[model samples]
Target: MPVLETPPLVHETVVSDRREPFSDIVIIGLYAPKIAREARPGQFVMAVTPSGERVATALGIYEAAGDRISLMLVVVGPRTRELALLERGDRLVLAGPLGNGFQLQALGKNVALIAGGVGLASLLLPAQRLLADGARVHLYYGARTAGALVDAELFEAAGAGVSLATDDGSRGHHGYVTELLAREGRTHETIAACGPSPMLRAVGTLARTLGVRAQVSLEETFACGVGACWGCVVPLERSSAQAPAFPPVAPGETRDYVHARICKEGPVFWSDELRW
Candidate 1:
């Protein structure tokens, strides 16, 4: 079956707004039925404010119910700043949940999840989905201080092995999540991560060095979450000689470079394939 194009979504309101361990933004979305159900774990949506500022908000499918979907975002840019200020009962236009999501099959292997700051949002639901399928999960992350960590309770409640690191030494370990992964991540069957670019890069490097299978979800400035807009393209690769082909685009390209669409093809991809 072909992937159905999600309908244009309409935002109902900002249901929750509270400061957590990461940044200082909390927003929820009320979308159409078409978008809410078809949305996958790694896809994101492009939202436009009434004032006409177009920005891509990359969020994970942390929760969903009926025609309503929830997304957690940090107010960081002019568009995000404007978005976070909306009150209840506000109407906003959105297009999503686009992009290719985390592949579930590869998740069968021994799994480790790494996240930093709000990047954890992208991995939370995927973690839940993984655990529901009886996978042993190890999670690692970092925050500026104890107050900067977000959503640890959710993962802990799910029975996942969780660890933390804080920059100011107010948490589990006094360092970065990568450091935590370095110390405790050995023996994992595979690895998956989402975080700041540097952290993802580190996860990719470490996974390659250890010869573990790894996948990463990248965040980038996107124009059209669909492939038509080249604005969001990043470079990536594939093992052409023996890899399965993704229809439409050629199976793989030179490892040096390939245009990756954060809106359509990704948010999640093999870390080694990316042309960082």
Candidate 2:
């Protein structure tokens, strides 16, 4: 019941430099080593670009190199667009390994991992853990084109079956991953996903209806990673009768805020835990 001390937002003694698609984006190092040590799949980082206090971005760690990490970010928001202009040596501020992460134990060998666009950033960690644990991972990844594809080969190299889908039919399947998922994913024992909310909700709805064990990482708007304000709360269904209701009418344990942090409670929640 006590407020979880969000491992105080600190400036890591040293920040590393990282390179990506657009921004040579100085890695600015890593934090939450404890959380990173145990960070489940579907967790993320809420970071601020030093340029402007209002410039904030939520980026998913694609690879963790102990003290160094990797992320995929697109130039969308003003903060990111500014972040896009950052060179390799810029300093960035971040808070957390925030959010409740995924659980691999609850998953089985017949696991189907689906991702839309850059949301694949959040799933990489979990996929690696799952494959290392000997689970049969089938990745259904969708993007706009060949250049957008990421980690498909990594998943394949890990011995998991991989499938690709692009809107332009420039890659693997010629349609949305959702369309393929509606058909092929039923064979899997579990489903895990991250991406746009609409896409996630569609999958979550299907998973719930089919009684398939499912987990989804959310992409919600957030302010503080520690849930101080109502900024990041998400709607979710009752996972159990005792489970709290989401979007609480009043403040109490009765509300279960899904993906509150995308960094802290989740970037992942049970499919049933999310409100469609």
Candidate 3:
């Protein structure tokens, strides 16, 4: 994973655009040039709700280009609902480009990118980077219905081969996306995935069964987007390069793994290195 030479800072930006591809799925574009320039694939931002009465909501950096970046989020609660209500020119405060992103070079020349529902937000940058590096990229995407599978054409346009699956059989395969990946066997050099816990675990299991390595970006509710609160901790193997530095374990302690903050050390980890 590449480190951001500059640390995260609050950027007061204005909404450049907003779109609702589905009922509660919102994509908000911000006129934030600094964020666009610093963001890495798989990293996220903590955006203060426009009302300022609620805690900041963590969102993935969906698209980062010249003078702009977009965030894709589902209106799951009061905070997100407030964010969804913002209009063009609405001011938004963000502390961003946080968390360690995916280690793309280690994934090699052929990669399978797996996404579930809104998890697609974290992956577009990786797909774009992989393609620009001359790698073969394939996307296995899934959603509840055909209508929920948004922005897949963006990947196709970026030169990625796309395969889709929906739970209700509205389009592509009629089952879990992991099933589609399994049916195809091991065709890629490695796998990179982001989605709900069950979907990500399935990807990890499938990756093991196929004798391929995989990296998974975890989705969790963050109280403080930085590592301050230690609220979003995951059990990771002590040997993982992404593990945080800690004091020597006492004689009675379990040395097999360490609790790593998803907001700081991760959001992305080697599937095989995760003890959860």
Candidate 4:
């Protein structure tokens, strides 16, 4: 994983493009050269609403290339609904490339990238980086339906072998994507996954069964994207390098783990290191 060398700064960006790949799912492109240059795969940005009435929304950086970066969002609530209405040429303020990204070099030569729903947003850049390094990349992607499996072709075009699964049996596999991954057996050296908590937990369990280590990007609501608030906390083994350092435990306390801010220490963590 690359170290965060600079603090996040507010960037005044303009919406260069907007696409509705599927109903309620929007991908908004922005002209943010500095954010595009500094952002790493799996990191995110805090998008300030143009109205400035609601708290900023945290979204994964979907695509970052040259002078543009895009954000993928699902319109689920008031905050996201407001952002989804943005039009091309609109001004959107962003504070990011925030949080740590995946440790690409440590994942070895062959890797399995798993995603569920919009979790695909965080894995594309990792796939591109891995493929560029001459590594074999396979994507196991899942969604609720065939139409919801947006942008599998993007990964295929990027040289990743794509295997898709849908809940309704409208696509590749009838069951969960993890089932497809398990049936294929363990060909990869390591795994990196992002998705719903249930799916990520399944990936962690599967990784253990396959005798491989897995890195998971935990999905949580980050009230403060910079990690000042302890709102997005997960139990992590204290020995894990990502664990935050604090004063020693009190004399009566014997806990072996610490509360790690998902926005700071992670968004990505080793599956084995997680106590939650």
TM-score, one value per model? 0.83, 0.81, 0.95, 0.95
User: What's the TM for model 4?
Assistant: 0.95
- Per-residue CA lDDT of candidate 2, range 74-175, in tens? 667777666555555556566555666677888877788888987887787888889888888888898888667765777787687888899899888888
- Return the candidate ranking by lDDT, descending: 3, 4, 1, 2
Question: What local distance difference test score does each model get?
Answer: 0.70, 0.68, 0.94, 0.93
How well does model 3 score by local distance difference test? 0.94
Q: Candidate 1: deviation at residue 83, Å?
A: 1.5
Question: Can you write out model 4's per-residue Cα lDDT over 92-156, one digit (the tens) per residue?
Answer: 99999889999999899999999999999999989999999999999999999998899999999
TM-score winner, 1 or 4? 4
Better of 2 and 3 by lDDT: 3
Model 3 C-alpha lDDT per residue in residues 129-198, reported as the tens digit of each score: 9999999999999999998999999999999999999999999999999999899999999999999999
Question: Lowest summed-lDDT stretch of 10 residues in model 3?
Answer: 1-10
Number of the predicted model whose lDDT against the real structure is largest? 3
What is the Å distance of residue 271 in model 3 from its true position? 0.5
Candidate 4, position 224, lDDT: 81
Candidate 3 RMSD computed on C-alpha atoms after optimal superposition onto the true structure: 2.7
